[model samples]
Target: MQSQILPSRAALVDRIALQFEYGQNLIVLLGTSGLGKSYLLETFITDKYNDFNKAFVQVGAQMTDVQLMTQLLEQSFNAPLIDHNLSLSQNYYQLAKQQQCGACLWVIDGGRHLSEELIAELELLSKSAPNVLYIMIASQSKLPFKEVVNIHLEPLNLVESKQLMGWYFT
Candidate 1:
């Protein structure tokens, strides 16, 4: 189960591991559908920390900007209704700031479904939070954040794919 077919990618994985260990604030994983981006992120997060404060948000096809922001805020804060008065965007930014202060790893999946406003807010948070790690999984690169280490995930090579299949199918 523990094998990798893309022997050339060993260096890439090592680089990513080093960045994570050195406290890089943002890591962007980009690839097409069915590339196992989510699986890789999940495996890395789970392997990294037992009690990691990880938040997962899957953007729906019909999700609006407000809805996306609210979902992100809710998941990050663990609060069902966070401030009824503030707008969804406002609440989301606030929650992101708070999470960054707490040094939590925020994983945003399906970010391509988010609206422009949500993306802007995420860019702002990425800039402001030095300690907060934001891992974004998207079909392509569209992040407005600067200095984001982008990893273009391809299908695992033969050896790695076989290992993954065996691990899951067994």
Candidate 2:
């Protein structure tokens, strides 16, 4: 398969891989529109951790905290097994306690659309959960939580832009 990791993004990809390798569980990828935040998330997961059980969820504009959490939990685990009676946090806590899920990675896209409250909650869960890594691709840089690995992406420079274009047109 052709590589999704572009020439300009190689360094960023390497840095992220290093961070994840060294036990960086909670990562927030912050970048402006058109900077390939979502693309980077997908590439990083697929290229680096394809063996992991993944829940790729897009956060919609009107989605509530409960909706977001349920979607992640349901996708990560089979919905039929999850206890709908329990609150979302309780359900998440229960799953973490099970310790049966090995190497689960959640890639949450469209994070800028969600409220900061929801983002903070997700960060907390990611920090607390074992064997689960959360990478949120967002334009927003300000996070309620302090202990997070924030990887910011920048637009490619003119030379690098030409190199990226060369990969497509050559």
Candidate 3:
């Protein structure tokens, strides 16, 4: 498969990998749309495929907190359905704690759409499972917590942009 090698993107991926290697749990990627955030994340995931059991959740503006949480629980753990909020979160935390996957990575794209409550639930997950990593792909929206390491992605430079366009057209 072919890939676009942009310096900013490569650097962002390196920074994220280094942080995870050093035991950081929450890493946020912030950039405007079309900044290659998803592509960078895909590259990172592919490179770390052997080290983590990764789950990618694409957040949409229409999804509610319950829906988002349910999607995550189903995708990552497949735990039984539970109605109560606390029970649902606890179940997810328990499964994360028991994860045998060398490390578990939860990558949420379009994370700006996630409600504050859902974000809090993610924070709870980080607290419960130190072996798990949360990579949130946000556009302009700031993370609520101060603890998260926010990596801002810059748009492609003239040369990189021309190369990308040339590759796309040719």
TM-score of each: 0.69, 0.82, 0.83
Off by over 4 Å in 1: 1-14, 21-23, 50-52, 78-89, 92-101, 130-133, 140-146, 168-170
Model 2 C-alpha lDDT per residue in residues 112-131, reported as the tens digit of each score? 77676666666676677655
Best by lDDT: 2
Clashes of 3: 0
Supply candidate 1's per-residue lDDT for 77: 64
Q: Write the per-residue lDDT of candidate 3 for residues 53-169, one digit (tens) a residue.
A: 667777888877777666666666545454555644576756655654346677778888877777776776666654555544554677786567788878788988987798779
Ranking by TM-score: 3, 2, 1
lDDT of 1: 0.62
Model 2: lDDT to the true structure: 0.71
Model 1 weakest 10-residue run by lDDT: 1-10
Q: For model 1, how does the per-residue alpha-carbon lDDT over 1-170 read when each residue is reduced to its tens digit?
A: 22442454455556676776775656777888887666556655565444456667667778776666566665556655567467554665566656543445567677677676666666666666444545555545556655677778776778877776886697
Candidate 3 TM-score to native:
0.83
Query: Model 3, which residues run further than 4 Å from truth?
Result: 78-84, 96-102
Which prediction has more favorable lDDT, 1 or 2? Answer: 2
